[model samples]
Target: MTTPFSSLEDYIALPRVESLALSPDGRKAVLTVATLSTDRTSFDRALWEIEADGEGVPRRLTRSAKGESGAAFTGSGDVLFVSGRADASAAEAPDAPQLWLLPSRGGEARCLTRLAGGVSSIAATALDGETVVISADLLPSSRSIEEDAAARKRRTDASITAVFHESYPVRYWDHDLGPGVPHLLALETPGGDELPEVRDSVETGRSADESRGVYPSHLTSPRDLTPTPRRSADTAGQALTPDGRTLIASLRVAEKRSGRFVLVAIDVASGERTSLFDEPGVHVESPVISRDGRRLAFLRAPFHTADAPADQEIWVADIDGGDARRIATDWDRWPSSLVFDRDGTNIIATADHDGRGPIFRLPLDGSAPEQLTTDDFAYTHVAVDASSGDLVALRSSWTRPPHPVRVRADGEVFLLATPAGAPAPLGSITEVATTADDGARVRGWLLLPDGASAETPAPLLLWIHGGPLNSWNAWSWRWNPQLALAKGYAVLLPDPALSTGYGLDFIARGWNAWGAAPYTDLLAITDEAVRRDDIDEDRTAAMGGSFGGYMANWVAGHTDRFRAIVSHASLWALDQFIGTTDNSEFWQTVFTPRGLTENSPHHFVRDIVTPLLVVHGDRDYRVPVGESLRLWSELAEHHADDDGTTPHRFLLFPDENHWVLKPQHAVVWYETVFAFLDQHVHDRAWSRPAQLG
Candidate 1:
């Protein structure tokens, strides 16, 4: 007999494949697989290679205690990756990730560059593998690599641990910014024993206490490509031209009220820059240069506001920023992961549609977009082999984790890698649709557990997705529906108003009115789902995180339909959340005082009748821990008169961030959730999770 899949232990231990990169010749492909570390406190990533033909078994490429990731192929077929491994010839900064190169034919990997702040991302040209560009952190006062190292040593010796900020945002979603700013560097590999020239773009301004050091001779000299002091470019989405002559990047431009992003093109040889595209109040990002170096494609969206909702549109322009046109202007969905087809006549991209993320083919000739894939699976990191028209992507679904797959011209998909273990049997997933009170069409995914039928119906669990802007189109390890299915519950995944894949009007329906259209649309879809014979409507629960958590809190106040509610890192008082969130300026532009007062869940806390389970992480900067604390305190005050029958609970993780990442914490999260449901929904005695004791 086959072993059954375990929810917390087995699911958290599964090897997750995140991204895929195809070789220039299209013969080899590299996949970045992240697995649980030995301590199970974090994930370790490594590069794995497989044949694009789907014949040979997958083989591990690089291994180290620190692990390797960000794999890319050079024009000469060599594999270049990033790691933090310590080497005797290099400076001993084990925390800093550096570049490493592995020979295409086969050889031991060698370290390339050693920077003080470490490398964040890299891009290489297909014309020559040796020509490369990297994004690294550098102190604003340091001009060269040696100066940066000296400044770092001085700071460490003084034991100073404070960051000074002059901007609106000091911290992002999880971590603090500053101490060093992001800078782009251009370098070429040394040929034969000849050392390349390294130029320091700015003068070194170190204090008298700073140490001095010499640059390594094995690496080529790097030139500072981004010379601006306070303006940092997004290197993760940066793209390089085929000839390696130009670099395209999205730069963050600071403004008085809110910031805007603009696309800029840099000359690799002359160190000159030109603004390719810049709109007054809009943000542009995700630039992809065509293989021929003739055209550039990017996504543009307005800055968040009540008047302009965040709906992204794809735009095409000449390499010199001329003849720009917005393609698929009439299309409803916003496209992502944009890439040029083998021919420059079309673009291949992924977008949220219905309840899934499917790839779409958009023609440059001004025609409507055509959906390529029909299944419920979501695709990401799409890559097309220029030599052949073959396409490859990382596909994932509600039941399946992300895996590398090949898409044929006829829309057939073939799995490229077979994971080691199998998950427990999953229920059947079907698409359900309904009309809201305003006659708007909404859709959702209904997961029916195994052996569920009309005679023995399964309890319903409404799982709301975060993003408020993001739809439930992809598989998420942190909030997998399989755990709920294994507990004999039917899961309902709904995409209400403000969810992408639908048009801008759908998003506008909930703009600054979060508690209005989105709530009713969710309710309408859940109403349709519970009507199914296999779902038990009388016994139901609701749960969500982030924006979904906000909705769960709203559900508790608005209706007593659910027996229990689980809200994770949710927004309690909108006024307080908008002022304290990491990106408060961005939210300030989107919400008004009236909207905050009208939509806040904390205002209606006195109406809550169902039991609630609040979960939060102290490290979550996006949705701070104070939101949950205030919620718990208010709920406690309201329930002081009642007996001990309600059984409301709170779960807190000190080390975690917005999401529960550690393996042990994830197990506890699920256990506590199910236990709370069993007590209120099933009318059973409250049993605390054994691990909590």
Candidate 2:
């Protein structure tokens, strides 16, 4: 019997499991699952617990309106999570995310700490878990929590909404950064009636001397662990030692020339900080400390510039900052989600291979890395039990959503949890391979609708992945191709040049030239896919977002093979885009005017012949809305001389950010896209989406 997977409505309603965390004793595991709310407007996440031995059924642990996430375990086996739920006794802010603790055996979770600014992240020691470190936002002028609250009240009473900027990067991907600076605080919790106390450590606040940098003091109870005048240091990835004495974190230091990240260790008692690893133009991130507190493993990559593309490698070093070396240097794929085994002799990590994200074990003794997983499914948030050596991860594929699974050391994989609801039956997924113009092998995934065959062919939809630096190796909720398959159309997902999981040499081919090998690789793979008897070569369309969107625009201008093209949040003019994008500083460092002029798609817009649909979000600062605006204006001007019957449209989202997040908005996006494709690719009558009306 075949599984059931239906339309977009059914697809969005499926439960999605994001992360997995195992307890210190390795007896239980907690998984974070997100499901659509009752109103279907957004998703609400909750923590679920399962037996690590795969003996007990999955059980829901915490339930709240605001939802709980970022689950971590203490040494006592109690689960700690962050949530925005209010506390009646402490009069906590309703929107601030506070730390909550759930007892090891079984009991109601209680609030652990209440600060002016909610906690963003938490890390604990593996030995006793008595010491915890949390990152929170603090206003510059406020020296205490009460002062911070008063400052906020005064601003609200005065109806004042202004943010003073003294540094770069005023805004991030989806939110504004200002008014408050991020600070790290250490807390001691004994797990009893005794309340947690903040210890005096590093000093907090900015100095009056402008030359020293803008380090304003804020609500630092004890003190700040990292306090460098004028220079702002951000804590990205942090891991506490087993004894809770030293904290190792990836610190991004802002400089005049460029921003670079280094791994540093901070003493919990004396607040002394020492740089463990620092490179001139390389960034170190995702630091994971061993249980014995002897080694550190992290991923390092070159600082991305127009001239340089990111190529990641795994690095291992002694905790004392000695014997540092890079491992898996010859590995083709980029490693992520680093975790060390119980013996500390091996490091477990995940990387995209071909079209799947597989788990690999790299030995510390310089042995060849061994592939632990052999399947078409992708895995993430991997955790290994120290006692049993068994693994638990969230696995997904093109035909399936994310779910919890248990993999034994002997290569035995078992599904731990299956969501309750049933989705409509999906089409078959197969591998497609071909050789590029450079004689390099390229691979992709093809989804063929049910009943498709040589006699009964299906229309093709070429979907390019964003992050020209990323790969299509995992299941995606936003850019899902299953919905298109449900409409009787086959979808092709290709990994062209610049796509990760391939070696660094493959990415260098398209480093500064967006219209070169990457484009040719895509075309080569597409040609091989359409040659299949089950695919209808004449009836095809192309679509992509971000970097993929840039490719979509380039494909439309360079070729007339496709009937229609959809470009979302794409870059049209290289010169204008480089200056307006949120990352202008980085772009200015690596890109030159000459190279941009030669590769920009806007220079060749007049050659376009395919019908185009442009989509963008006003809040997308990464690739500003102006790119879409310019592309639409040029397309309109080019088609103005032709018959006014040309079907070209623009879909704009005012409230959405880089990605379409709202449930209703996502539904509308798919409806509009499918309707446009049906009209141009299938010769069907035009139908306006009901949601638009």
> What are the TM-scores, per candidate, against the unseen true structure?
0.94, 0.92
Q: Report the backbone clash tally of model 1.
A: 1
Q: For every model in order, what is the number of clashing pairs?
A: 1, 16
- lDDT string for model 1 (237-342, tens) is 6677887778887878878634788898889888798998789878888888777889989988877776658667899999888999999888888876899887
Supply candidate 2's per-residue lDDT for 74. Answer: 77
Task: Show model 2 residue runs off by greater than 4 Å.
Answer: 1-5, 92-94, 123-127, 190-223, 227-233, 304-310, 418-425, 641-646
The ten-residue window of minimal lDDT in model 2 covers: 210-219
| TM-score quality measure for candidate 2 | 0.92
Per-model CA lDDT versus the true structure:
0.81, 0.80
